[model samples]
Target chain A: MSAAAVLAVVVGAAAAKGELTGDPKAGEAIYARCFACHALAYNRTGPKHCGLLGRRAGSVAGFEYSAAMKRANWVWNRQTLDRFLADPLKAVPGTTMGYAGVKDRQERADLIAYIEQAGRSEVCRAR
Target chain B: MSSRIQSPDASLSLASDAPNLETRRSFLGKSGLVLSGAAVALLAGRDVLAKGNRPAGSDVNVLNSALGAELEAIAAYQVGAESGLLQKPVLNLAVTFQGHHKEHADVLTKTIIKLGGQPVSAKEKYTFPVETLKTQSDVLRFAAMLEKGAVSAYLGAVPVFENRDLAKAAASILGDEAMHWAILRNALGDAPVPAAFMS
Candidate 1:
């Protein structure tokens, strides 16, 4: 990730966590695994992660989501994302994302920070 | 991985003893007890009908059907645990998976009721091919086959939901069912993560 992106994520992380810390740079590295199926702007094997925060589950238009995901009523935020990042199946039950999940809490937090910051880009915003 | 070809169809049929599934030459069967794929057919019935295709039944039908399957799964686990054929570890795992099914059933029941639809009741008796449970391997294989069908059934129903929330609920169950399949398949000496796209 670029230095500016890292800075933004760090700042955002501080605000979201209220004195807790996360490394966006490290999170970006962690997010590499997710990149195989997801992109910032375009949907691939998984839905695009851009603007993922605050969006309701399975609400992405044009994406084929599972019935369970389409029915999920919760909004995506830092806390929800953290739990989901730690264990997708446990968090969402029937989500189709095939990855087992990032088990490390710190790693998950970092990934969330990176994703949140990435969502802010003009490219992501355009979606 | 074992030489057994993963037969998603015969295993998911749940109709008969599933002779094809029996003939697959699974390592589980070779190890000790043989598995009958008939149990998985439980989900193959109208329980999986998507709302889009048959709006008359809609979400209530799908939820009720799923509840029935979950109750069956719970009963299956109860039978397996009581049969004494499973190893202690395997038995514990079965119990845990059964709990997950119970959770699914609870959610389905509540959702159905919330929709002003009556929830389906658990069967007083289910006729699983219990005679096939000759060993721990048999129990795991049987459970694994059932989990695979659950994954397929939920995934198939996901796109059909008129209600997005129900769709999301199905997706959540699909993820757990997939996890259960992976673990059980691994125990049966098969490559757990065999595909990029889940069937």
Candidate 2:
């Protein structure tokens, strides 16, 4: 990330938590970091990607879901995902998604916006 | 990413592989998983959160739930594509699969509306473990995990739809999701079909 981009993200994070707004373009760039374990379609190190927003926490197929994930009544959306991403371990105690959650408020907002954008990108419509 | 009109068939059919498609053998490479020990703490025992704890309500409610999953899938695929981490063939595969989800969402949405229930809309946000996603392999593993979940989820769904037709449709989609799971497993060098039946 460039110094300017870093500065923008830091500045963005300075806002009050609940009032944060996302920049999809910035989020899209941040999302490149997510490619290590996820994809929009196929499964990778973790579960698949495209449906991360609309479904329940452990609803995707072909993977072992932790009891915590299966039990949570959480249906992912902006507010819900935002809360979860703010601290995944704190939110879902036994989730197998083994990473410290993204901490930057603006970065989180941007990442979420990019996630929403990813579903409709041309590459995702390849079929 | 633009909202352009599309014919139904366009999103559901298999197009040729992308320009960067690898050979058949090379195609066989993808994902894995690991749980964090801190998540366990050796003696932890409390559950958390409460939004998704919904049971299948009426037939309309059940279908709406399915619709929600389908919409999430559409979003996930496009987002993965934006990442630029996938190989050309993998990206092609993701697109084809994403198209399948769109088909699923379309049917679910129409069915919900026809049944006099408001179809659920896509959620405002979708989150993933971006910190773990530093490589293409990680992307594959994450995808595989989700595909496996989809396979299990549809198994539960197929039996729940009170409408026999809807049950059949869910079953069909379940098969498709299974295929995706198997292929990803194969790519990762694991047994594609690991069991006689879904657990």
Candidate 3:
């Protein structure tokens, strides 16, 4: 109705569009759940997840795992991990991983991204 | 635009026997008000972030402690799974517990990294809770206690996590941990929600 009001609206829209998006830092914190069972080392808790981006499941060392997991010859990449984390039982019927997977897609991606970074860290390499 | 307005007025008079310009204008005005409100909200959100008053990080050590506790829980569950003491259902539950702990460890590790620190690696060959758990009932009871401890630990650590998302994540996991405890309680033939504290 008024020129001042229209100008205000235009300015507001511009500001809103410039707002910061998702926080990788926050995503990093959200990734702790994966660290327990999946490690970026040769052997930590459940398996050595180092360089797991394209690796297969049940391939980690020294971990006496369930037969269900050992049978899944699938690779551990972003998309596969996302689906598996979304619903572990649904993704692999007999897999021993009992925990329900992460429900959020963005969170799953963030967790995977964090793991990718962690896998490349010096400590991970040293291990 | 003028022809359109005239056509609408003629149709209104023909259909309702009365033209309602006032009602139509009021409806448009109400919608304008709603749009203005939305615009104001958008502006306010931008101003808040522009003020550079973003949330702060929580106490790092408390998060580390939480990670440590989760590590312990994983060790306990893995041992239980291997001891041949757990039934199929219980063994499945243990595996699930392991995954949950792994998720917790991953999040905590990221938090530590965000704060410019390294996550502590869990020690190999952790001491099991075998001495404390002797029977099937005892294993269930021990799990319930462990879950309860996790819930309380998460609650206590919530205040220390400065990041709102981190705090919410902790709360979310704590709720799930409580659920796991309830499930284990029911499996053991106890009330899902314990009447008294396990401690």
Q: Which predicted model would earn the best DockQ?
A: 2
Q: Which stretches of candidate 2 lie over 4 Å from their true place?
A: A1-127, B1-57
The weakest ten consecutive residues by lDDT in model 1 chain A span A35-44
lDDT of candidate model 3 versus the reference: 0.59
How accurate locally is residue B126 in candidate 1, as Cα lDDT from 0 to 100?
A: 50
Worst 10 residues of 2 chain B by lDDT: B41-50
Ranked by lDDT from best down, the candidates are: 1, 2, 3
Candidate 1 residue A115 Cα shift, in angstroms, is: 48
lDDT of each: 0.66, 0.62, 0.59
Q: Whose TM-score is greatest here?
A: 2
Candidate 1 global CA lDDT score = 0.66
| Candidate 2 C-alpha error for residue B165, in Å | 1.8
lDDT string for model 1 (B1-199, tens) is 1111111211122223334334543555687663222222223222444332332345665666567667767777777666778775666677667766766777777666656567867644454556667899998987887777677567656665666556766787878888998999898899997788764
Candidate 3: regions farther than 4 A off: A1-127, B1-58, B195-199
Tens digit of per-residue lDDT, candidate 2, span A22-118: 8999987666544434567655444665767887878888654667789999999887888887766568865544334667878888988888887
**Cα TM-score per model:** 0.45, 0.46, 0.43
Q: Write the per-residue lDDT of candidate 1 for residues A1-127, one digit (tens) a residue.
A: 9999998897797777663456789878666555323556755446779989999989888776767778778799888887776666557766655334676777788888889888887767765
